[model samples]
Target: MPDPALLSIKDLHISVGSRPVIEGVSLDIAPGEMLGLVGESGCGKSVTALSIMRLLAEPPMHIDSGSIAFGGANVLDLDGPALEALRGDQIAMIFQEPMTSLNPVFTVGDQIAEVVTLHRAISREVAMARALELLGRVGIPTPDTALTRYPHQMSGGQRQRVMIAMALACDPQLLVADEPTTALDVTVQAQILDLLDDLRRETGMAVLLITHDLGVVSQYCDRVAVMYGGRIVEQAAASDLFAHPRHRYTEALLRTIPASNAPGTELPAIPGTVPPPGQRPSGCTFHPRCHAVVDACPRTMPELTGEPSSDSLLESRRMSLLELNHLSTTYPGAKGAVVQAVSDVSLDIAAGEVLGVVGESGCGKSTLGRTLLRLVEPSGGQILFDGKDLTALDRHQMKAVRRDLQVIFQDPFGSLNPRHSVGYIIGEPLIVHGVGDQASRDARVDELLALVGLPPDAGRRYPHEFSGGQRQRIAIARALALDPKLLVADEAVSALDVSIQSQIINLIAQLQKRLNLSILFISHDLSVIRHVSDRIAVMYLGRIVEIGPTETIMNKPQHPYTQALLSAIPRPGVARQKRVVLQGELPDPTKPPKGCAFHTRCPMVMDICHSVRPVLEHPTGSPTTGQVACHLYQDQA
Candidate 1:
């Protein structure tokens, strides 16, 4: 009645040393179906995918029990030659980090051609031709030039496309993509996802997609299996799981995302963290974090069953906290040129509100955030905070203003000092500001760590000892040390895994409520921006193109750029919509276009857009009190 599974794993038990990682995990991927494996970091999503390919190192990592069946054979029992024959022929894998996965010495084309030659009895020239064809198919521009380029010569997205081309070299029966789009920008992510979907349709290849992004799982995968602490917590059709999650863990995860709730309201976060290997709680691994915990939850594992009667809106009211009037920040470039990193950017963030700024890299969102904190001194315009022009404040005067304005940078590791202990990192703010003595600062550091969901003793450790997510928590603790009224969180959660990303997002929301701190949240992620922001601002090369209520900007985007971004978001379980892929990269800031900077890439570009710059104004019949900078709305005014 149904197509047989292209790949199947039954009763899989994996262990690294004496500690078990994946216990009795089972999964299936039918031909032409996309299966998403989701979980937090260290939850065996990647390990399981590796196990399917027998890629796990033998001594430390061992597969004690399980059968990975593919193409009517048990992959576990295959001999060296047989396994080698199977790999890259019938089954191929695209790893999360292409930089590390691809060899550094070889050209991308040489590597891809090698795979083609190895699998098929083809000449080097034939293989090279096939490699070029694969590159073009995966949307890489100028495949001929790319053929000679090494992995380091390419951008992250380009490298990933090369990885995909190599994976599809043999047109394998099954494709295993592990967190393929995690590090990519949303536009590139959309392109990669689209490429995968297209390849799947054309070749009828099954995809085993593993990722922590629930948004991706919701939109891309046909079926979903949610993993928790190395075990399958829940499995169902993607739509069914989203509509009605049976497990508490699944429900908590779905409810915790910012987009799932109302703007400004605190997100429901899953308490505590996943336990270390072999030290799982006696019965349920998730019992510690489960909000719907029963008394027996700690002693007995609840069978995955549907008994869910529950659920969840976020609308944030406005109260002006900070305002910018024609704010501009610029830097001198080569030969008398000026790079307008941020130009005439005017917006406001309400008290205890998240005003999200979204744009591609180099669109000036990060510069705008820095300008708000006076980290980048505004060359022009006024930055009004509590009715005072921050630009006019002297160094001594600005030092006091700095107490109310703090920032959290994108790279947590880079932002934090390597030589400093966690305690010192968090307490330094208090020390520098003359707020407390050494003993009092230590106590305050502990308190701040607890507030951000880190253990009190985490203060004793160094930054390198902690994971990326933990390091970000430490950064937040430091940001909160000054009791700042406004936080410039520039791409704060962008570097984290999806599950950890949710934790940080929720933590920010929680802190925003606890301290009533206004946030200038800047990121390229539209889904995350829509979830947390009270109002949304879309920026293009050095200028604000649109600003509106979150609902209006996300649901009914008026600006063409905003519309393109929203459409690019990969929603799970839905057929890929016809997206407006903005052609070409971001324009050079030093030499921008004559009028609207976005006109070059805009699909609905008009003659007027090329000659006259648009201003932020209420679009005709706009449902909300939002503004757009577009010629399309010019007549509406």
Candidate 2:
């Protein structure tokens, strides 16, 4: 016989101000089991998770009907004291954003110790000791020093680890983690997930992981539940669910993952966004956007059913549109130390080709992008654009060249002016370049907006008036206003929900083809980079470790850093493979490693790697094999 469920939620119906947010949701998590609850944003995944812990605000959020049972006890019926005891002691939660969830005023030690002291009758010294132990367990380096550091002083990954440590202080019977890895890099994300899995096995605690990332679910969870329109549409074992999904919604979501699709191919994005809480359609909330919608889908709701469910580079031999010849960008750090943001990078983007620059945070990918456009002045090396040296151009000359080189930033709202209308924002480039009159610019704005799949009248609204995805579209329109030959898309779609990300990615691919524009796409997501890039460049500590055709790099990465990155990517519908988790955090940019920049964390590091720097070259002495910078590859050539 199997063990009783550690956490059981039945017939949960939650409403916010008379509007149903979660309707008829039921889930079960057995002891030591990890259950993934997945759906697009606003699909009630978080609401359901919050309801399980009784964390929802009272006035706006009320449980219409439901029961959450933990160890056969009704959580909904608990009084104030009982609820307080239940929380942190028996049930702990790790919220999505650690920065906000963690108390900013306290040190890491104080915050974690408070959880221990509150749950257990322990002295401050013992609580502090426990906090240090938890920190070490969660993979935080130098736990003693980390305890005294403020939340703002640590990296995003470290902050998340602290959050995890605090949650596990009491060794709760169940842990509710909501999008814990959403903002983390793939390497850090893998480490955090692995830590959780390890701790679960050791402590025998169940986990309810709520995320939109199907890839994470496929690898970590024992079972999966699919939510849509505030209801559970499908639930099954992870393997069974991925292999043969019974629900149409589940099938659609699997198709939308960039890793599951071919390189440079258009993603089959679900049409329209998720309907708001009070504005869901009559029957199926997904019916309007569902590709496999039937006549019955719009009029009749479907029951929850058991289901088993399941880049080629640009080939055109065009001339180089942009060329970086031994490019380097350096910034002066504190105490007159020089930070090597971009070091000795050399690459060329063929006309209309998409070159992806991928690495973990602080790897100099973003700095490389900024340097290419002269937004940050380079310390050395030449930037040749269309046979003209950009470094040689004066301010006036660069201003004219700016019309041919434009950029799309990651945060749409931050890049856009709140006070300006979308039309003005899009047409500002034309005004700056003195390309057309007001009437002509307005016409151009409408054309640009239409090109990005936005309605013509959308220009009348401000940035705040539009959704996140829509705001990104406005940013794209603005970038296209000048019809640049090259576009630097710096983490373009990383901020969006998965469905919306697909839509934007498809739109970018479409526009790239239509305009025959070269793109320098920079991101930390290897999966996404593979989907949109013709060629991939892996950066490590301000240098390119490898550059190759997307298919070649994805299949046979040569550099240790590149291999580790590819190995860390979570593949949906597939079992987790052995990952090469790098042992240490990124080295300080101001004082990089003596020889190979990645040697400090390289698993295959040798004595030579510790003393001699490797140059980027064809690993197998064949141009077609691509360039790799590593001591191991040097001998292979």
Q: For candidate 1, what's the RMSD?
A: 23.5
Give each model's whole-structure lDDT.
0.85, 0.87
Candidate 1 TM-score, C-alpha based: 0.51
* Candidate 2 TM-score, true structure as reference: 0.51
Mind giving the per-residue lDDT tens digits that candidate 2 earns over 336-407?
999999999999886667899999999999999999999999999999888789999999999999998999
Task: List CA RMSD, all candidates.
Answer: 23.5, 24.3
lDDT of 1: 0.85
Worst 10 residues of 1 by lDDT: 307-316
lDDT (tens digit, per residue) of candidate 1 on 1-637: 4556667788899998999989888777778878888888878899999888889999899999989889789999999999888899899999999999999999999999999888789899999999999999999999999999999999999999999999999989999999999999999999999899989988899899999899988998887888998898877678767864656678888988888999999988778788878889977788888765544456556443211111100011122468799999999989989999998988776555689999999999998988888888899999988667898999899988887789999999999999999999999988878986888778778878888989988998999999999999999999988778789999999999999999999999877755556799999999999878878999999899999888888888888999999989999999999998889998889989987889999999999888888878887665567899998987822
Q: Per-residue error at 166 for model 2, in Å?
A: 89
